[model samples]
Target: MTDPAIPLGEIVLPCLNEARALPWVLSRIPDGWRAVVVDNGSTDGSAGIARDLGARVVHEPRRGFGAACHAGLLAAEAEIVAFCDCDASLDPGAAERIAAPVRQGSADLVLARRRPTGRGAWPLHARAGNLALARMVRRRTGLGLRDLGPLRAARRRALLELGLTDRRSGYPLQMVVRAADAGWRVEETEVPYRPRTGRSKVTGTWRGTWQTVHDMRKVLR
Candidate 1:
């Protein structure tokens, strides 16, 4: 049974110690859309802040990006499920535009192509890694995707049907690979990428970026 209170679409925010960014992130969610904040064992009071700001907080004890993302997906009841980082690196409001294609039955998956709005918004190492992955994706799937970005939207039922198994950094790549295999229509739109409020947990350091690339490469293989 669908809850009438539940909106037609919801955005899943995977949070890890993002208390400082919650207020801005939650406030920017499109009107009439629900925000599901999945707390991935944050030592900070991220969960409380999200709840206080009227976001539906789901606790994901597992400490991985995919784990938190999947937890939020499971907690969401909306027809459209969108994902955005809780770090405030990307605008949640852009979700409305990216999700429109899915809602209108024009695309099965929609990803945001991040165009950094500031000089330091995107780290050089992270960008290089992302570019390499995107090229690999194009070669493997022929999707013509420019970025394996965090801001994305898809139908909840269809996304679950993809049977995503990755519970780590490889999760997003796995989603695209599986979607390509399933012959799903994937689309991309440009969005402003801003500097995050707090230090990034992943892709903020050289080692972190390497680990992320390694995790994703395993999926590619």
Candidate 2:
């Protein structure tokens, strides 16, 4: 049966050196929904793989996750915009859940909460840090979000109305906080999260983690 909640729109994938996982990610997407892949200066052939898999590719030279996401969002020509990491951690079917609230006109933004599907999926520190950040967000903005996970869906108009300015790595937190501050109806849904295909950009490296934290701090203020 056709999902009544799935919006007629496109999904945007922001990628960097994700050639190995692109095909798997593309294959999981349901038919009738198009995808736009934003290649953020990938040294590998991630763009080529995406193109071969029938995804429209956009090149963004800037090396920031937020920048890539913003570029993809602007390029999307759909009413509802879904964004996911190209690493395949998020279940593709969860897109329907994320878009459901928006399609029903009940929420402007839907954030996915990631629950580890198996052992050794998410590192201990990362999980703890994410929970702490979520708590902090709830305390500051009075908006409870389970996870600022990469899997998310929102109305394009509502996203634009939030006036997102952070073009760095902290884009996810910035987006949620801004949406809450704008009084947008935000909802959360549980999504299964598995380990990615390649090395994690943020948690795998200390430099990446530090940079992410710094960027997040800058945007939180």
Pick the TM-score winner: 1
For each candidate in turn, give its C-alpha RMSD to the true structure in angstroms. 1.2, 3.2
C-alpha TM-scores of all predictions: 0.98, 0.93
lDDT of 1: 0.93
What candidate 1 gets wrong by more than 4 Å, as runs, is 1-3
Task: Give the per-residue lDDT of model 1 (tens digit) for 1-221.
Answer: 87889897899999999989999999999988999999999889999999999999999998899999999888999899999999889999988899999999999999999999998899999999899999999999999999997999999999999999899999999999999999999998899999989898899998999899999999888
Alpha-carbon RMSD, candidate 1: 1.2
Model 2, span 144-212: residue lDDT tens: 787887789998877877778888878988998888888888888888889888888876665666666
Q: Whose lDDT is greatest here? A: 1
- Each model's lDDT comes to 0.93, 0.83
- TM-score for predicted model 2 compared with the true structure: 0.93
Residue pair clashes in candidate 2: none
**Count of backbone collisions in candidate 1:** 0
